[model samples]
Target: MRAGPLVVVGDTLLDVDLQGTSQRLAPDAPVPVVDLAAERPRPGGAGLAAVQAARLRTSRETVLVTPLADTDDPDALKLLELLEAQGVRVVRLPLSGRTVRKTRLIAHGRPLVRVDRGDGRLHGRTGLPDAAAAAVRGAGAVLVSDYGRGTAAHPVLRALLEELPGEVPLVWDPHPRGAEPVPRARLVTPNREEARTLAATARTARSGGYAQAATDAAALRARWRATGVSVTMGEHGALLCTGDQPPVLVPAPPVPGRPDTCGAGDCLSAAATGALAEGALLTEALEQGVHHASVFVAGGPAPRGSDTAEAEPWDLVRRTRLQGGTVVATGGCFDLLHPGHVSLLHQAARLGDLLVVCLNSDASVRALKGPGRPVMGQADRARVLSALGCVDAVMVFDEETPTALLERLRPDLWVKGGDYGPLELPEASLVRGHGGQVLLLPYLEGRSTTRLVQRAHSEGGEER
Candidate 1:
């Protein structure tokens, strides 16, 4: 099944980041002194969750419900821009209080301290307006991301859940101290420590051995009326228990190299939500979620020291330059990364010293093609492209046209399929402007991504 429309509600936050290199130790202490390089902010809390959902549900409609203060925080604007770029419809609930901002202090690539700013109060206690309620009602599934910032309190959540039909799925990631007994939720995900806490509270009237753990978890699920319960155990992996199914244990995959564990849980929750929304069974969704989480935890770039880390854009121009070799640059969605794409890449590599393939990010793909496009994700596509021996580098751009990238790379020769005429190609001018030649390689007749997607759909293949 293809992913369907999703609604996300909960606290929204701003993630303020400071990045730099440490050149010397602090005079007062042994801590390294960091020379700031760049500063940026990303959406956090429910906002971050919404971003992940947008990626997974690239082909489906997405709506976000959160309270935001009308303020001058660039971080807030950045977050909004990101959501808009992803084609997500954000329904902002006005709040007089400031948006939550978590600022991290880093030196030499390692985090030293984090400072949080904002009032920890929930806004719009009157309940979701009729319009917001209608939006949630129209969604196929709903996810609540609670960060204990008061946006997802009992009143708002209850109102939203009450509006959802029973068949429409509801998943909850509860805040540590939020109101409990989430009656309408189909599933509840809590980490091992949180599970233990819930268990201890449930058994306050009874005493038992280690069996108390299982008993408590089951009791909590029953009390909440949730069909499924998931307990994330970090490196130990996760355990999923459903009412009628046997408990399933999913072990964590080995990381290729040590990686920072940040955002793994968010990735897991997002993947699970996406799979469930797509109609996958609980077990199947859990497996895919674990797989996605493993990839994130294993493949993220390493941190520097005490300095905040940022991902550097892949330098396709450098990689496509081989000694005494010609360079070929091509850009596209490359959605399926099929054998045809492999053949074209190989053919392009043969004509040049190196092959640099630029891919459209999920957002760009959606803008170019209507909804229900890009059979694969940007990260997945990039990974596949990088793994190919014929491909030298892969870069992701969130633009309808790759003219800017073409200008930056200034390849010796820019190549595209003959399907497009030179007059219609936007990158042609950029390549020519950089003193680079443009070539139109003959496209494989009768072999195109559109045809492949149509055939796959006809054969009952899942859209995503």
Candidate 2:
């Protein structure tokens, strides 16, 4: 069965990073002067939660339910576009003020300072929109990513949240200034500090570190009437408390360096929400959340400059689907790049917004085409295909067929160049089962890899 959308309910913000170089100290001040470089902007807060959740989901599968200001503020408009571009469907409510924007200045890859502005909050007199209410009711899992921007405090929304069915999992990521989570929240997430502040008991001081986090999580779980509570400890990971059981320590994977943890909380919450939406147990979801959040932090906050148009194969597929674009995939040994291969790739590219070539691994190629086959190594073939304008990405698979990769990618179109019937192919049923179309494109005449190989051998020429 298809999974329902994961609804992220809270405040959205615009986050920008101003990256630059810092050199000699200024003559007039003690601080060094910064030479400006690139400016990167992305969604923050609930918007961030939505974007993170959308990473593994298809277009419109992650919904952001937030209060958006009706004004024409550039930051607000930009945030809206960015969220939509990442495949988040926004269900906007009325806002009483300007949208929040947080700008950080970074020099030499380290954050120097942060400038925050905007007073956006849910309008006091605002009523829940029909669409927003409908989204909550239809959510497979709900994450209240409250940033204390008043969306979580809105009475109409709070009432709606309280009325959700028991089967629906509700995760509340609390903020200091946000309203308390409604009763029956399946889980409540709070950082180490927030847990202490919300629980409001000096007993937390009786312990320190993980012990304190565990105590606070347990206290808050009971106080807030939530089934489970998780206290996130940066780098250390999270402490989960549930039903009088001993707290579980879900450790974060160790990274080589101190990584930027700007959105680690949102990443964790979003990952857990997505897992829960797909019916994972709370413990399993938290484990996934920890792993995903760790990877997210390890990747850091800034994007590395890319010199090529091609992206990682999985990323290409995810990004295409997120942008509501079609993804096309084709598979082959591709031992030798030939005119027929290039022609098929070109045609596949035209059928979708992105084309991923699933190349057979060296082992798989040998298995399928004999030991003497695969004139080129898998790595060289992947590199060559990635350099092609018609190919957005290349994925090498060890399996005899690409059914496993097809299941993972779920491409919109699976194109194959041959004279064989399309439905008879091994991966055709798998692609069709996932709502993808399979098409057989005609091969270029007089262009064959085997023929080229034979000619090269007869002429005493090495394979190209």
Give the runs in model 1 whose Cα sits over 4 Å from its true position.
Answer: 1-4, 72-75, 154-156, 201-216, 299-464
Give the backbone clash total of model 2.
0
- lDDT per model vs. reference: 0.69, 0.81
Give the per-residue lDDT of model 1 (tens digit) for 1-464: 32347888877787776866667898999977777766756677777777667766345677888777664855567768866775668887766566678988765445677898777356557756666777676788888888776666757657768667766778888767765636857677777667777656555333432334355557678878888877776765667778655677777765422344656776677678777887888777777777666655644321222111112223123222311235678889998766667767877877776577878989999998779888788888887887676775676778999877777777878888777799988788878887888888777777778888789788987744
- For residue 305, model 1's alpha carbon misses the true position, in angstroms, by 30
Q: TM-score for model 2?
A: 0.67
Off by over 4 Å in 2: 1-3, 58-60, 203-207, 300-464
How many collisions per candidate?
16, 0
| Candidate 1 local Cα displacement, residue 273, angstroms | 1.3
lDDT of 2 by residue, 224-307 (tens): 889899999988889899977899989886642335788999989988877777778889989988977865664532222321
Q: Best by TM-score, which number?
A: 2
